[model samples]
Target: MSLLQVSGLTRRFGGLVAVDGVEFNVAEGEIVGLLGPNGSGKTTVLNLLSGALAPDGGSIRFGEHAIHGLAAHRIARLGLARTFQLVRPLGSMDCRDNVIAGLAFGAERRWGSAAQREADDLLARVGLEGRGHAMPGELTYIDQKRLELARALALRPRLLLLDEWLAGLNPTELLEGIKLVQSLRQQGMAILLVEHVMDAIRSLCDRCLVMSAGKRIAIGLPGDVLSDPDVVRAYLGDDHA
Candidate 1:
């Protein structure tokens, strides 16, 4: 069975339909890409899935449970975790403590020294090994992103949702991020990635779902989907048409 199944998922704001009847699935140990241009509803889909926003319609099934309409915290406890397009770390807390909070209260609910050890391991996994004592404001942009990933992993989620996690990285950092994602997949965690970096998408995704104007325009292998005429038109305007 799929780790996550979303069907006819939708959301609206005033007169704008942010996500329209979107549908897709992510299986265990697989990385699925959600590709689209800006305003194409990609992040909205993540929001709905992670319970950051309630859907106006459709179903989200994680395992056997229907997750749409559930409270964010309730949904999180069911083994689903996500990182924001804009990293939001607790600035006042040190890196380790921020992750420790997730370990203590997330799906696993691990606490005390045990949670601290796990948080340390996660920080190391994300390449923030010895920086646990540093404050969020003190770290560089890339380190902050890694901290976000570590916090999400502390949930011990069955499915991980990533939103543009590779947006602002240098070449070396980008390569490191990609490798980290691959390692997570090797460890059997399902990932739904929303990324603008085609190189990362091409490398990490087993299959991709492409969206435009709040609707699916293409779905297939990364190479094929990226080459699709519709996708090209969406990303690069069809002014000649």
Candidate 2:
């Protein structure tokens, strides 16, 4: 069944349409890729789904309830959580504390000592086993990204939105990142990720939704959509296609 259903989703900034009547669905335990070049409104769609930005038109149904204009926290409590393109852990909080915040505020509403224990476990799961005491500023870029994943997972969400969570990494780190995402998929987590790493998308996404100029250009199996002439033109220009 679908965990997220978005129809006629539209968002605008003044006269500029950032996301134009985009529609898609994420099924339970399925990983879907939102693909496009820069400024295709991918992140805007994520923001709207996670309730960071309200859509001017369209409806978002999470599970059975409409959530188009709900507050971000409310959406989190409704089993939807997201990580930003740029990691946004609490600057003043340690790694463990950052995750604790999510557990406390998320769907299950964990708190106190229980939340701390679970936060540390989450940190460990994301390959940050002994780094919970460190501040976000102390982590390397990839470690910080792992922390971001841990924070989102602490929400115990049914559907997770990841915006470029695998953007920058060396070869080895990229491999590890792919493995980490694979582990999440193994655990039956449904994910909608916006990523530019084609290899990662190919390995992780069961389906892809392509966008261009705020419109969905293609939607299908990764191999098919990525090979579509329109998708090729959008990424590499007409010359490469």
The best candidate in terms of lDDT: 2
TM-score against truth, every candidate: 0.97, 0.98
User: Best by TM-score, which number?
Assistant: 2
**Candidate 2 lDDT tens digits, 64-154:** 8999999999999999989999999898999999999888888778888899899999999999998889999999999999999999999
Clashing pairs in 2: none
Pick out the ten consecutive residues of candidate 2 with the lowest summed lDDT: 103-112
lDDT score, candidate 1, position 38? 96
Candidate no. 1 TM-score? 0.97
Please estimate how well model 2 matches the true structure, expressed as its whole-model Cα lDDT: 0.94
Cα lDDT for residue 238, candidate 2: 96
Q: After superposition, how far is residue 159 of candidate 2 from its true place, in Å?
A: 0.5
